[model samples]
Target: MTECDDTHGCDTISRRAALTGALAILASATARPALAQTYPTRVMQLIVPFAAGGGVDVVVRVVAEAAGDILKQRLVIENRGGAGTVLGSQAVAKAEPDGYTLLAAPTTMVINPALRSSLPFDWKTDLVPVAMIAKLPFVVTSGLKLPAKTMKELEALGKTRGTPITFGSGGANTVAHLAGEVFGLVSGAPVLHVAYRGEAPALTDSMSGNIDVMFSTLAGASAHVKAGTLRALGVTTAKRTSLLPDVPTVAEQGYAGYDLSAWVALVAPKNTPPAVVATLNAAVNGALAKPEIAARLIEIGAEPAPDTTAALASFMAKDAQTWAGVIKAAGIKGE
Candidate 1:
């Protein structure tokens, strides 16, 4: 063999490497569509960051069940409630970026980051919003025995009470807790927060007169309000909800812009394929469009709020900002 010059051999190797890389890229581009098209070969896990039987869990189960039918695959619900939603949320954040693992969380997903200085994962960076399922306005409810029957009366009573008026929350830094803090800020009342394990316990305490006030989801407090166990002062929405049509909103009740509600949405670990996100978003919206699913959600005091991925992402960003301001103003701390 003739002696090979160094330049010629190196140039040939580089060209071959470049060609191989080009072919590999082309193959990957071709495979992505196929993978997205044939996704969900296995069951999908929808992790609810709250306990079963709570408002979020109940609503998600209904929507997930419907969406599962539309996607023609099982969407299994796994409740991982603890640490004010941090436990379950962290699980999803650390899970593989594959579409198989999903998070079905409430507003707490956004609120936690604002209230806590240190979190296991950064929600804004690690979790990608897939779809918004529903939103439920909070009903400012009081124990039946409380002297206040209206928001104004509650504020007056809270100001005059020898001890700070106690408000029950599902947990520290939860939406309910933040709502109560907002109410206190707007009304200039001295309020004490009582944290519970979940909404069920908070509602139970409210009904038993153990707590003076609770900003509870319409679903969690409606039955008690209707049964005369809890009194509805005002709803935490800009307008009255159809489920509680007779109740006035906090905005209309002299608190001109007091709108706070709990919302549920689906999110996945960052880097989940865009095609998978699109597939899930389409399935969620399709399920929300079904009259049966809509009716059931409304019956439980939730409004179907299916939206595009970009819209949900923007909404969550704004929501987080709003809550961050509120938390900072109120000096709220996380558990």
Candidate 2:
């Protein structure tokens, strides 16, 4: 036999080679659990792309606690807020695909691509959807100083004000900011967009009567509305939120099609095993089904909708199409 064949020959193999093969097999057998089955042998990190108090972070913490129950391990949340969630998203995208690293992303997941031409990571391709947790309807609220009580009245007042009404938003390219822009487009109202560091700063300015109006997730403005600091004119969603059931939707108020809501979802790095994704997704769905979880989400003006990866993907694509057109038409250049 040729030397090459002999080297790999079954019968010609040396006792030393046999011993080496046996040791390699033994090592693999011992390492299998650490590499696979022992997944999350420690705490898994879920990176929230926004500040701690935001809607996305709030919902994630709720889901994390519930999911943790099933996993029997702590699901730690890390807040990496900045650059409109890009920083956190990029960090998760580059993380190892061992399912230990996850991302708590917002509806901005789809909108960011349309806003910025060059992103650090490909959101659609790099992030694998684990669960679509819930959606927080955008509230069209104004400072208590604004006289308008309804969307139509707000439009008329905008005309009477003459100058484009300036509105405070969480940040540029955020869902609330984009929703305000869309509202302006549909209502034919002149609104000059103003970006803020976060909802708190924006609401503070709104409460101070410095800003005329603001678009925010219901959770951010719910307490302010209860305290009479801000006036809720209408929600920017198809259906009225349970938290603000008395308030009409923008569509019901005047605009025919003014539904815009921001969502929170869980995702892992691309290439994560499907089984792992399903396990996490199932946990989230189960958590949302809990009465306590649903009740808490309702209190925040959010609707619980634990959906599959396919459903999340389809919704994201639709959101991307809708907002991409709006962003492009409005010429929203990113920072």
Candidate 3:
């Protein structure tokens, strides 16, 4: 064999390696779409970043079956609640961007980063929106004994009693908590915030007249309102819900833009393939559109709001902006 020059051999090998790498990258790029097409070869995990019996968990269980059926695969829900949803969310944010692991995120997903500092993942970028599964607005509720029936009435009563309005919430910096704070800001009232372990206990206190008022979930407050244990002053959404059509919205009550809602969304880790995102979004929307499924969600207080991936992204961005303003004005911090 003829001997090769050292520099020429080195250059030749380097060029060959570079070409091999380029071809490998090209092959990978080519395979992704096909791979996305055949996604969900196995069970998919939808993590509920709250306790098993919480609102997020209930919503996930409601839609998981139909969505799984749509994709021809099983969707498993895993509860990883702790650190105010950080523990479970971090798992999803750092999970492989392969579309298998997803987060059934809630309003807390947008509230946590601003309420807490130095989070392990960047809330703005670490995860991507896949679909908005359900949304339900809060209800301004009071105990049967409270004289106030509207937000303004509560404010005026507080002044007449020579005391600030007492409001209880599930926790500090929660959507309910901040909604009360925002109500105070817009209504020009001195509001006292009492934090409880969860919304259930706070609502229990509200019905007992221990607290003057609470911004509560429509689901949690609906039964009480119907039973005459709690009075629904106003809905916190832009418009009244059909379930409570007779109850007017806070916006219609004179706070023209005072609207807030609690919702659950589906999200995947950053860099999850767009084709995979599209597939999952379709699955979720199909699941929600079913009449039985829609009825179930409505019974639980969340109205099915099947959404496009782009719309979900815009919704989350707007949600974050809205809560950021509330959090800043309230001087709230996380545990």
- Strongest candidate by TM-score: 1
Lowest summed lDDT across 10 adjacent residues in model 3 is found at 50-59
Candidate 2: tens digits of C-alpha lDDT, residues 1-335: 77557665655567668899999999877664444445656889999877667666677788789888877788999988778778888999999988899998787778888878789999889988888888888897888777887888888877887887778877778989888777777778898888876677788888887888889888778878878878998888898877877989899987887778888888899999876787788788989999998998888777899888888878877888988887888766665
Q: Score candidate 2 by lDDT.
A: 0.82
Q: TM-score of model 2 relative to the true fold?
A: 0.84
Q: Which stretches of candidate 2 lie over 4 Å from their true place?
A: 1-37, 328-335
Residue 234's lDDT within candidate 2 is 89
Q: Assess every candidate by TM-score.
A: 0.87, 0.84, 0.78
**Candidate 1, 1-335: lDDT as tens digits:** 43346778878988999999999999888776777679878899998877666678788999999989887899999988888888898999999989999999689888887667789999899999999999977888888789998888888998887677799877778898888888888888888999876678788888889989887888777888888888898999888998889999988888887888889999999999998999899999999999999999998789999899999999999998988888887777664
Instruction: Report the number of the highest-lDDT candidate.
Output: 1
CA deviation > 4 Å runs, candidate 1: 1-30, 330-335
- The backbone clash count of each candidate, in order, is 0, 0, 0
- Residues 1-335 of candidate 3 have per-residue lDDT tens digits of 33345778878988999999999999888786787679989889988876565444666798999999999999999887656677788999999999999998878888887877668897679999999989867888999899898877887897788888999866666678888888887887788999765567788899899999988777667778888889999989998887788899988978888878888899999999888998999999999999999998888677899989999899899988878877786676555
Per-residue error for 144 in candidate 2, Å, reads: 1.7
Colliding residue pairs in candidate 3 = none
